[model samples]
Target: MLFLVAALLLLGVAMGSVAHAPLPVSLVAAAVIGVWLVVFTVRERHSRRHSS
Candidate 1:
């Protein structure tokens, strides 16, 4: 699932570049995804700690 997301993101960036998406739009996408990843990591760690 993570690999799929990453592959899709790369595909989106490539297609967006080919189709002329604005730079800020791409930056914002990356930023949002970055935040999501950080949050997910934190939650996963917290959950693992509680489980063990």
Candidate 2:
């Protein structure tokens, strides 16, 4: 999740610098990463509660 977020940020910057166009791909990538992070965090919290 962290990797995805970092990658998306980097890609967005690169695209912005090189192409100077709107970064649709980077926006989608960031959204995907954000969703994955939220879902994983929720699942981890639930698992910890049950295990304890």
Candidate 3:
């Protein structure tokens, strides 16, 4: 609930900033965020598997 709202807010802010950013900067930022999400997903999966 709160987390979802916060995530949505952050996403909106990020998107807004990205829209104003230069193309190259936006691309790099997106790549970094993508990598971060991948890493976060992998870690969460690993943690869950180990916990279970």
Candidate 4:
């Protein structure tokens, strides 16, 4: 999960630098991170509930 987020962040940086469009790159990265957080949080909650 961490790896995925890290990869997306790196990709975002690369794309922004290469394309010279920080705004779009930032928006994409923000969306990806937001979705990832929601999914990760839900999975963690489910796991914790099952464990107990």
> Which portions of model 3 miss their true places by more than 4 Å?
1-12
What is the full ranking by TM-score, best candidate first?
3, 1, 2, 4
lDDT at 35 for candidate 2? 100
Off by over 4 Å in 4: 1-21
Whole-model alpha-carbon lDDT for candidate 4: 0.88
Q: What TM-score does structure 3 among the candidates reach? A: 0.70
Per-residue lDDT for 1-52 in model 2, tens only?
9999999999898767656545796677679989999999999999999999
The residue ranges of model 1 lying beyond 4 angstroms of the native Cα positions read 1-19
> Against the true structure, what is each candidate's TM-score?
0.65, 0.58, 0.70, 0.58
Q: Name the weakest run of 10 consecutive residues (lDDT summed) in model 1.
A: 14-23
Candidate 3 structure quality by residue, lDDT tens digits, 1-52? 9999999999999889988999999888889989999999999999999999
Give the total clashing residue pairs for model 2: 0
Q: Candidate 2, which ten residues in sequence have the lowest lDDT sum?
A: 14-23
- Count of backbone clashes for each model? 0, 0, 0, 0
TM-score of 4: 0.58
Candidate whose TM-score is highest: 3
Q: Predictions ranked by lDDT, top down?
A: 3, 1, 4, 2
- Superposed by TM-score, candidate 1 places the C-alpha of residue 43 at a distance from the truth, in angstroms, of 0.2
Cα lDDT of model 2 overall? 0.85
- Mark the regions of model 2 whose C-alpha exceeds 4 Å error after superposition: 1-22
